[model samples]
Target: MTDFQTAARAATVAMRDVFPATPLLRNAHLSDRFDADIWLKREDLSPVRSYKLRGAFNAMRKRPEVPLYVCASAGNHAQGVAFMCRHFGVNGVIFMPVTTPQQKIQKTRMFGGDAVEIRLTGDYFDDTLRAAQTYCAETKGYFLSPFDDEDVIEGQASVAVEIEEQLGRLPDHIIIPVGGGGLSAGAISYFGNGTQYSFVEPLGGACLRAALKAGRPVKLDKVNTFADGAAVGQIGARTFARLRDVGLANALTIPEDRLCTTMLDMLNVEGIVLEPAGALAVDALKDLGQSIRGRTVVCVTSGGNFDFERLPEVKERAQRFSGVKKYFILRLPQRPGALKDFLGLLGPEDDIARFEYLKKSARNFGSVLIGIETTDAANFATFFAKLDTNGFTYQDITDDEVLAQFLI
Candidate 1:
């Protein structure tokens, strides 16, 4: 076996003391629907509710002589490091952006207990990173990168090791969700050319796709934080080194809204709670289609540290993407029967979620902002057709990002 494979196996062995290998369970629902053998490497079931602890634990164990460890993260990485620090009985200082959610901050503290110090600094992640690095340097502490370090990459390879061992053989294809590229890079390096791979990234934060396109890591101009687990602006340099040659054809970028549908499906259909990043791999199954039929496929469901408070937003996005919900600005004649006439256009399946007038009183016409929900995407066609036949003037603002932000 290669040195990387050897080291990864060793890390996998070491991980037993902290947490058992996460489940590699066949997802019957997905398998039946896709007409393939679909297994989920359930990293979402890990102790820290993510595969991040593998990397953090492995990296920390290698530097046993170091007195202190420092890391900056606004999410799973922080929790992983804190959990490791407690397990190893080592002093750790974790830096988080001040804007990080209270639930995440509390979880990190709960994991580390007295073994770690939580420092909240800076309004943004980049700023928090600077603060953490500066503190590490000043204190002569070893800084553990979330994914960029060599040790961490090898640690992440434990996931691949566990997959092969649990499955009793290599699967035909592995779909990996790409953030800073550690898990995908480690898996790719561990398997080499033995297995096929599909690298998935959120469309708003597709650092891996962008880097592969540019031939180097480039900072994205914008990153949507909806999928905070995979919302990386740039792929890590060390992680990208291993992933740079993976090619654009093998990479897929999932639209953020479309990804929400997968999350909701898993929750409602499978009783699985997946954060946006965790759903990326399963979401790719829709695009893979014929390529994976009748083949053995494994998708790494990366994390489940989801806040229930985001359910409404997730449901909203999922409905919008699935074409079951929409918003419209309608020009209504400022007459008593105008609303009743417009309401008459809604089909049996259509429900008015929202209806309000922009102006309480208008001379001839009133601007009505309306939100509608239906059972079928095709139902919208019928509803809109009815609006047309009635001479109702309306603009669909559901897809108008700026307008939706302002008006909806």
Candidate 2:
């Protein structure tokens, strides 16, 4: 075993004093869907509902003399550090973005109790991270990075150690979610050449993939924060150093909207709760297709910190991705029977989910915003063809992100 792997195994053993190993359970639904023996490393069931606690615990445990610990995270990392603060009975300050979810903020507080102080700083994480670092430097407190530190990587590697012990042997493939690369790096160090690995990232925040392309860590010009847990704008330098050798072929990026569809499917069909980042590994299975068929694959379900309030948006995105929902701008003639004639063309499966009349741009033509839902994708094709044959002028706005953002 490599020296890193040795440290990872030791971290796994040390973690037994904190929490039991997360389960690696075979998932029948995924196995049936992919024609593979699919298993889920249920990191979502960890103490802080994330694998982050492992890194937090390991990093803190190694430095008992560092009485004051500081960190910057508005989501899982903050909660992880807070939980560790309470666990180690140490003084810590957690910096969080002001726009962080109330649920996360409350949970961090609950976990830390009086052991940690919560600092709500800038609206963006980058701004908050800088603030935390400056404060730590000035106060002589140790800054605990979310992924860049060696100790954290050692801690995250515990995931791989547990998998090897529980599964008896390495699986053919392991799918892991990538944010800053700590978990992926740790796993790679632990498993080495024993297992094939696939790194899953949100398309909007594919920092690791971008870094691989650049041959070094590079910041993204813009980041979509929909998958906030995994939406890191830049790959951490130290973490990327460990992951720089990862082949671009092993990285997969899933669209944020498409990830929402997977989240909904897992929820409704499998009764599984997955946040956007948590669903990354499972969602990438579709892209792998036949390559992994009949093989044993383990997908790490990284976190389940999804707020129930986002369910409506999740359902909307899922329906949209499935083609069961659509939005269009219909050019309606300003004449009698026009509305009735349009309604008569509807198929049996089609239902008007939304209808609105915008102010007319012309005296003879009135613009109408319409949203339709159908039982099948084929139904929309037939509906569109019928509209074409009848000389209906309409623009499909379902895919117009900019316009949809403003109007939908």
Candidate 3:
């Protein structure tokens, strides 16, 4: 075995004292759908509902003498470190963005208990991270990076170690979700070239892909935080060093809306609750259909800290991506009979979820904003055709991001 493999195995052995190795269960549903033997390394089932706890525990265990720990994270990593801090009996100061979901902040506080102090600092994560680092440096507290530290990477490698032992052998393909690159780096170090690897990242925060293309880490201009767990704007320097050589072709970016589809599928069909990032690895399978047809594939479901409150938004995005839901602006003639005339165009499966007049005072016509949900994508084609045949003017605003954000 390689040096990384040796270290990873040792880490996995040490982790058992804290929490049992997460399950590597063969997913019959995925296997049947893909026509391949598929296994899911259920990192979501970890004590902190993420593989991040492994890294936190390993890092803290190595620094038993350190009295204080500091970190900045608005998602799973924060919970992981907080959980570890409580377990290790160390004081922790966690800095989070002010805009972070209250659910995540509450979970972190619950995990840390009295051992940790939660600080709501900056408006964005970068600001929160800077505040944490500055505080750590001044107070001489140990700063725990989510993915940059070597010790943390070693801990993450434990996932690969457990996978090998659980499966008895390496699978033909391993699919991993990438954020700051820690998990992908650790897994790559442990497995090396022994298995085919596919790296999946949320399209809005594909720092790994951007770094690989640039030959170094670069900050993204903007990031969509729908998949908050993996919405890293830049790849960590240390992680990028290890992952620099990963082929571009092996990296896949999943659209935020399309990822919602996978998240909903796992929840509704398999009774699995996956955060958007957790669903990344499994969602990539749709893009790799033919390539993995006859192979033994392992997908690491990274985290499942999904807030039930976001279910409506998740379902909305899924429907939009699946082409069954849409928002539009229609120019309706301002007459009492015009409303009754338009109602005749509705199909059996068509339902109006939202109807508001944008310009109610217009003398001749009114601008109406409408949200329509239908049984299938084709239903919209016929619906639009009927509208055109009847000379109705409308604009599909479902894909107009800025307008949708402001109006929807």
TM per model?
0.98, 0.97, 0.99
| lDDT tens digits by residue: candidate 1, 177-210 | 9999999989998999988999999999999999
Model 2 stretches with alpha carbons more than 4 Å out: 360-362
Select the stronger candidate by TM-score from 1 and 3.
3
TM-score of 2: 0.97
Cα lDDT, model 2, residue 75: 91
lDDT of 3 by residue, 32-59 (tens): 9999999999999998899999889889
Q: Give lDDT per model, in order.
A: 0.94, 0.93, 0.94
Clashing pairs in 1: none
State the weakest 10-residue window (summed lDDT) of model 1.
338-347
